[model samples]
Target: MKRGEAILVPLGAMIAGLLVFGLFCAALGLNPLAVYASIYKAGFGSWYSWQNTLVRASPLLLCGLCTAIPARAGMIVIGNEGAVVAGGLGAATVGLATLSLPPVLSLTIMALSAMVCGGIWIAFGAALQHYRGVSAVISGLLLNYLAVALMNQLIEGPLRDPSSFNSPASYPLTPDHRLAYFAGTHIHHGLIFGAVACVLAWFLIDRTTFGFAMKIAGGNVRAARLAGLPVGRLVVIAGFLGGACAGLAGMIEVAAVHGRANESLNAGYGYSGILVAFLARQNPLVIVLVSLLTGGLLASGGVLQREHDLPDATIAVLQGILFLFILLSDTLYGRLPFFRSRTPEPKPHAIAA
Candidate 1:
């Protein structure tokens, strides 16, 4: 089952998701294949479609880290969306406040500040877990609510743009300050950052001493502590790293996509990252792949809405079904015959003897 779980299961589940969608479409008297074709044309049929998918997936890739990386140490960090908002604000604030700085210098400061914001956000949950025995899940979710409220307050009050009598947002970043898209491509450097981060995370979690420590601690915290591993530090660092991913996502949104912090800054990339992490089974590289897949769906949502008269709710329903099925299947891995442990067979009855 583990072997099956590696790829085949996910593929099967995805097929199942499509079948479920077909069933739903039938009930609604719509053609499921037509809708799916629309999704394909809008999401992957052209360079433009692929670019949009990558653009959207870039944040999700980082946001996925916000959940998957920490999960290595048994932490359920879900406040990535908040970290994203805070990170974007941090980047924007630095960019706006330091107009005299070189672009590289300013961008560095902005990205670092955003990371700090995200790190601290998850650190709060870690602190609660270490000191108070509070559930990280609850604390993280509550932190999300607080973060959203804080974002609202900041955009509506302290950070409100004075010039544009339009949407509530912080002062926009200067065009010169925005990250440049590669020539002939809409995808920005955030996709590069997300890829780098995912690779780094794979190294940290699967190839290093820290990774070994997390494996030990995550397997048995008590035994790990007895073995002199700094379990607390591992957990805390994992949580912090998770938060940093979210924060970096925010920075990307502000510096590359939106050019400012605003209400839309918390547009649920964080939440979607959670879904991606679950789908990837918390594997960093797999998270990137899953993010791209989901990003394609997201990219198609607009076209699905406009061209086919499909409501946004249609996409939402698809996402819900996929997420629900993926998570539900997680418990079944390692238990099936295809994944069952293999033991050496006892020597055949000594026919030779």
Candidate 2:
């Protein structure tokens, strides 16, 4: 495969995917054209709606990064959920522990706690991959379940708010401790943080030396090892960074949205993040655009359910279709002649250790 061929495969796949979506919508007694209109109107027709979509997309963009970064190193770390909850729990702890501290000091502590906890949460998986050569996909996935279990234990046990007789959740942050919205919108600080993280990820993967090494290792681990690059360190760091990004996303979800750690924090963003990463080819910048697109799907689901007499499950159907096409990305890449030409012929780059 060569460069030009690589480009065509994805392009062709996009066209085919749209057709599939259209067919699915039509068979369900819905007009694809009108459904699209409804989607546009519901999501972007009103400023409030658009803002809401952005808010939803904020965490998704970060979670997408959680998948995208590690992909470059050939590790499929699906444990973003663990990092997210861990980060959220860490942030809640920070806020509660520093209730009497100055506002700035408290905020800093909360942010650092989330980042550190998120990093450490996924670092365990990275260690396993590097030390034992365990499959990251499997290890990370199992760890996600573990994280969920841990969250349940913490919230129901030690972190439970005794004052909440009706709801079971971690202690809520005081009003002052919650992150405020941006100047003009209900969108919170997390959007800006997500945007910044995306930019940083793009730079790290596309412009930095580390990125290049990871790409090579991902393309062929044996080749990379032959070239004497530190494959173990690269793979582990990729997973750790990816997990940390997800953890920050969790922190943002708790601090800005929930204002307290709860089961609601497990909103499936971790799972959806996988979709975004795959659709974007696991490219950081592309993840941002894809997140917004999926966010619109979520934002519009309620509208369709209310006005079109469609079941709320329409969103699930659409999502299912999207994931179907997304997983076919590998097949699309090789099958399309134009994109097949884009894939590089075998390279002689030095093998990493």
Q: Which candidate ranks first by lDDT, i.e. highest?
A: 1
lDDT of 1 by residue, 1-353 (tens): 35556786777677788789878877888888888998888889899999999999999999999998888887888888878887887778887997788888888888899899998899789868976899988898888888888887888888888875677888888888888898889899889889999999999999999988988877889999899999898888888888888899999999999889887787878888888998888999999899988898888989988877879768778888888777666666665665666795567877777
lDDT of 2 at 192: 84
Question: lDDT score, residue 196, model 2?
Answer: 92
Residue 301, candidate 2: how far off, in angstroms?
2.7
- Residue 100, model 1: lDDT of 84
* Alpha carbon lDDT at 40, candidate 1: 88
Candidates' lDDT values, in order?
0.86, 0.81
Candidate 2: tens digits of C-alpha lDDT, residues 208-262: 9999999998889899999999998898788778877888888888889998888
The clash count of every prediction, one per candidate, is 3, 23
